[model samples]
Target: MSSTATAAPAKKRGSGLFQGLQKVGRSLQLPIAVLPAAGILLRLGQPDVFGPKGLGWDKVASVFATAGGAVFDNLPMLFCIGVAIGFAKKADGSTALAALVGFLVYSNVLKAFPVTDAVVNTTANKGVDVAATYNNPGVLGGIIMGLLAAVLWQKYHRTKLVDWLGFFNGRRLVPIIMAFVGTVMGVFFGLIWEPIGEGISNFGEWMTGLGAAGAGLFGLINRALIPVGMHQFVNTVSWFQLGDFKDATGAVVHGDLNRFFAGDPTAGQFMSGFFPIMMFGLPAAAIAIAHAARPERRKAVMGMMVSLALTSFVTGVTEPIEFSFMFIAPVLYAIHAVLTALSMAITWALGVHAGFTFSAGFIDYALNWNLATKPWLIIPIGLVFAAIYYTLFRFAITKFNLTTPGREPEEEIEDITKA
Candidate 1:
């Protein structure tokens, strides 16, 4: 009967969803944190930066390559631990430990059982080989195990066992349950992952086939999904070995980034487009944010803008600028996405072939410059996008009076929260 009664449930639901996102974000934070180091290491080891592939810096590159690859190769393990810790109510590390155990078991199970035509075949899919050895599901599987282990921890951390099994109680029981669940998940993956892998391969093929157009489309979809945090799934699928790649040494690499690292001849199509956007476009957007701020807050906004701009340029972290206007000016966000797609398409068409361990940024661009087909092209492309971003974002913010970051009214608080 009351307005409060009608609105209270809705408010609770909203808060509940926000909290869930916070948890997921926390889980991803640690695993994502390691990427910068991994990227830097991989870049350091690449012979292109030092000399020619056959004779240049083999010893130096080998050391860093192995060190860096360790992180990328073990991303699933990191994801499992991070997500488990993230989802835990207590966040006491118990869930993380359990998740690690479960993920290991699950990965081993997949390895042991492998794949079969009977298990993987879909009548419609003909090109994919069913007998091919599949890599462990990696981060995808890690996220699943982490979530499951978190549940086991939540239920059994305080659980009391029967008289005969009194020792297997509370924290002790968490691992017990996860061990079985992990093995079951492994079997489940064995049965289903190949078909799913084939599907992802097809998707990657379709994107590559579209060339610049597909890159633009991919850019748009990636940005669209950011609000829900599901963007990571799409990103991982594209960045990792989802499609097949046989390197020069006869090593089959999977995913765009992985293939690039493995010396796959195909080139980094999905990855080439982002360099301009992350290293230049987002920074330009940051500048526009500062310029759009009211005169009174211009100093503060500029300070914020400078920091975020530097971050975007160096590390490809664009959230500080993205979140500032994503909600207030959905139209501008739409435009941003479209422009991002265009950048990807354009650069891709120009035959750029660089890949990054973390994101499209100065570190990856500069360090792997020699590895690319035309690394010099990235600089001009970046400059063009920077100018484009500044012009478009500045005009939109002022013309529409969009409330971005420091431009928000005093009474309206921007929620910096994200998952």
Candidate 2:
């Protein structure tokens, strides 16, 4: 009667919710795929690990920084393009074009709202001032617009207009719908963007206010939700601008990564803790999992296990190892989460602020090294956690007889001889 037994059926029963969520998760890949380059460039622009801090490194680093900043700055547009393409039922150019059209409609309409001001300002030539305050609405806004565009594209792409107006039928008709959809969206957000933005910012502030405990909680939630693939949504708040930070520079930063690069003193509240887990802890788990395999299977599984460990350690991708035991033994995963939470708390308390361009792999760790408060601290923390993860995973897997991958029941295997 373990919850793990019901997880699959429960997912199937909630097919609508799960499928849509799965699609959103899948759509995220495109935008995320581009992040590593940006992160590397940003790191290159920062003062080197051995050099002094501040803008001095900008001369050489500026090229890379600006290159990377464009991606960070225009995340919304990228999401619109990425998600529209991802969610489109068919690979058609119209869907992508329509997404852009939708984005422009929302951007332009929201800017010119409160008609009197738009008109008066235009006449008085104070429109520039009005434009100055226009909020870009960032990634969250982009996701919404992208989803809306894809839905419209899917629904309208095949529509046929009356023969008299047939020229605007089929693919041509989608953009027309998106234009209206975008305006409606624009008008909708124009009135309430402030409250919505403020609410999210407040939620971020609340999370950050709890300090190390908040980070620990996030770590637990992050690992806990991986079974459902919904952790990314939770992470979106911290990685992007779920929280708002207004800095001394009179500029505003919304997310952990954004605030960190913006030179906000409190940047990396959510990200700093993951380095230990990704670069070391998970790899150790991989090793333990491999070692716990029956000796015969151990040799067979070692190559795969080693690759998973290296991938997680080098690039911070953990799905391979996480999937190894996520379902067959939920208890182990729960323990893993608890360990992750502890790691988060420890690192956060120690004030290690290294953030990542991609995952908390060695690459990002090295890149964000100089940008942190005590980046060197993660090295020792990660090393210690590796031993902890190895010992804990080995002991628990053996004690509970958890069926992690190569150690699965023999009868469960598909035999080619029988087939």
Candidate 3:
């Protein structure tokens, strides 16, 4: 009885942890979803695109750039609000208000007590040496505070107070509580970061120094995590805070995506490798799977596979193709992970630097072309990968008799037909 009881609780704990993490991942998507629009505007406004020199829409392009820049510049604020809304039970305005209040308090406290020695002379700061004044805790901090606010709200939003203190009961109390909590959090982070700043900087340097091998490892792990739906955790760090770059205006940006948009010359290691796989390799694999289907099922499979292939090629949504074979033919998925890693490493070796705000689809590839290094080379490389994927997938499906997609058992197909 004791063993069973203990086992049940343990299982519950594990399940709860997984669900919480998945919630965090879903919450992160709310803010990330806004980036595509921002990216399109920013790219369109580039001087070589629709800006002064290219399309001669100087003032209009500047307006577009400025509007897009507003979103990027305030990403941390948006993240906090988004995370709070995502986590709230009711997802109401109160949660967002508390998140904003917490963020403001935390930022102001950091401004008063800087954590790093990095100084800036931006118009916003006016030559302040306070590291926390401008973009201190950053998106990571915003995420933390947002999570904290949500938890605090969940815990206290329904509490009843003594009659004397009734005015601060329930939902109205969240922001008030977060103000104090944010102050404490701000001071704590500031104290900790003073000694840890060098460590963080060194870690960033180490990640950048890993080069192709690092990107390859990231790609492999990224694909492996898809089955469990946990790739977002790995993605957030690499895309948001992996490397650092200083822009032409002397402002620093972090992460592959941010740096790429800021025109950092060496910011696409984590992103360039995806284009070939999404736009070519996976589509070819889908065709291979369709051809490998039973003669009777080939027609049905082709219709479904064609849509999946086009989705991957145009939007870079590979889950449809990957999931179709992942469960029935696990070996194919394993090979895909390895292939993704190889793609990342190969792209790095070829000095291909490209990026996408959403995914490495045809749209992003074309939109970011002017900013990419060796962008045209992706075509020949993609064609080669297409052939490789098709050949290897066809050979594997035939050799192992892997039941991919339409290759299900005759009994199962008959059952579906009867139903």
Candidate 4:
């Protein structure tokens, strides 16, 4: 074939794949978006709606629970399918089939060996073994498998083979190769998985031991890391780095210490600290900015302030609020950080266990509250944080003439965008 003709096919395939991936990404968005809201609703609305003798409540609750459960349960499957299709050259049904093949191999390998049993034998302990084999197949693993399968499919989907294996060559060969790859991956994971998991668990326990100081540090680091994508890595350490809890029967139970604080028994030591900062403290800071604004720019500043406060309080998206003053007045940002630490300390001291999956906004608060132990205490603590935020912010802005919002000198206003 001529060079142009050969390249044309490749170019066409690449373009087609890109379009397909976009469609797949869009399709996945709806399902992914629903996950958080469904989680919140099921958690918050469950008791009231499913309580004894409630009106049509049981059915409504059951439906939401079932739908949400399916999505939560099948996240790995979704990632495999979504990513395979997303990365494939043709974005065909075959790509999805290859993904399934890879997923099955990866999942089964993790499930095959009981890590807890191995540990038990090594320790010779009659005591309960807290470690389990494997937790749920995560998004990272699924995406890796998907990409591997897509590559295999693209590479060998049309290759010929020897007589006996000839039938398996081409598209049919992708899955067979994936199975072998999965086996190799399984062996690799088996070797290092235990030590890695333990190391992570120890790290988390250490962080938890840091108590209020740790919480403050986490908040500060979390904020700083958001501009980059490293936050997800940090989150993994905080969230799923631990192995499953093992029961007396040697069966691995599906729960982690992190979840204990944020999932059930909801008074997670680390998570509760964010409630005050997100729900109350940030809003108070916004108000202070408004108060500090130049009289002429008060209306403009007020508009920005209101938007920031609402987003912070209702949705827990602090970037808009933080960015508003972060660059212009870094001292104020430092104060915000200090106040966050203080809030964490106060909440920790007061024994509040509030946790949120999204931001520390009211929506997540409402969703997680019902599932949390002593959920009602969050309100009182948050109110206190609000008072603290308002007082400190007002004092600092006035005392320093910090160029917050409207208080920026006219010359500085032109440079605000640059900052």
Per-residue error at 12 for model 1, in Å? 8.9
Residue 120 displacement in candidate 1 (angstroms): 26
Model 4 TM: 0.68
- Per-candidate TM-score against the hidden true structure: 0.83, 0.87, 0.91, 0.68
Pitting candidate 2 against candidate 3, the one with the higher TM-score is 3
- Residues 1-419, model 1: lDDT tens digits: 86666544346657777767656755776677787798778777777653356458778788887788888778888878887887778768677778888988888888766443233556656644355465456667888898889877888799988989988878888887888998899999987887777777787788778888877777888888786666765676677646677665454556777777777656588788889999998898889889888888899999989999999899788887788888879988888888888888898888878887777888778766766778788889999999999999999889988888778776553344321
Per-residue error (Å), model 1, residue 10: 5.7
What are the clash counts of all predictions, listed in order? 3, 2, 0, 5
Considering only N, C-alpha and C atoms within 3 Å, which residue pairs clash in candidate 3?
Answer: none
Candidate 2: tens digits of C-alpha lDDT, residues 162-265: 99999999789888888998899888888878777778778888899999999999999988888987787777767886666665545566788877876766
Sort the candidates on lDDT, descending order. Answer: 3, 2, 1, 4
List the candidate 1 regions with Cα displacement exceeding 4 Å.
1-26, 49-57, 115-135, 248-251, 405-419
Q: Candidate 1, overall lDDT?
A: 0.79
Ranking by TM-score: 3, 2, 1, 4
Per-candidate Cα RMSD to the true structure, in Å, reads 6.3, 5.9, 3.6, 8.8
| lDDT of each residue in 1-419, candidate 3, tens digit only | 56555433346658988988888877888888899999998988899877877998898889888888888888888888998989777768889989999988987887767434565786767876544333355678888998998898888988889999999999899999999998998888776755554565576678768888988988999999888777877787788866778888677777789999999999898899999999999999999999999999999999999999999999888999999999889999999999999999889889999999889999999999999999988898899899999999999999999999889999999999899
When summed lDDT is taken over every stretch of 10 residues in candidate 4, the lowest stretch is 253-262
Off by over 4 Å in 4: 1-34, 44-48, 51-60, 75-101, 116-181, 242-263, 398-402, 407-419
Q: Give me the displacement of residue 173 in model 4, in angstroms.
A: 10
Could you tell me the lDDT of residue 10 within candidate 4? 42
Candidate 2 pairs with clashing backbones: 240-255, 241-254
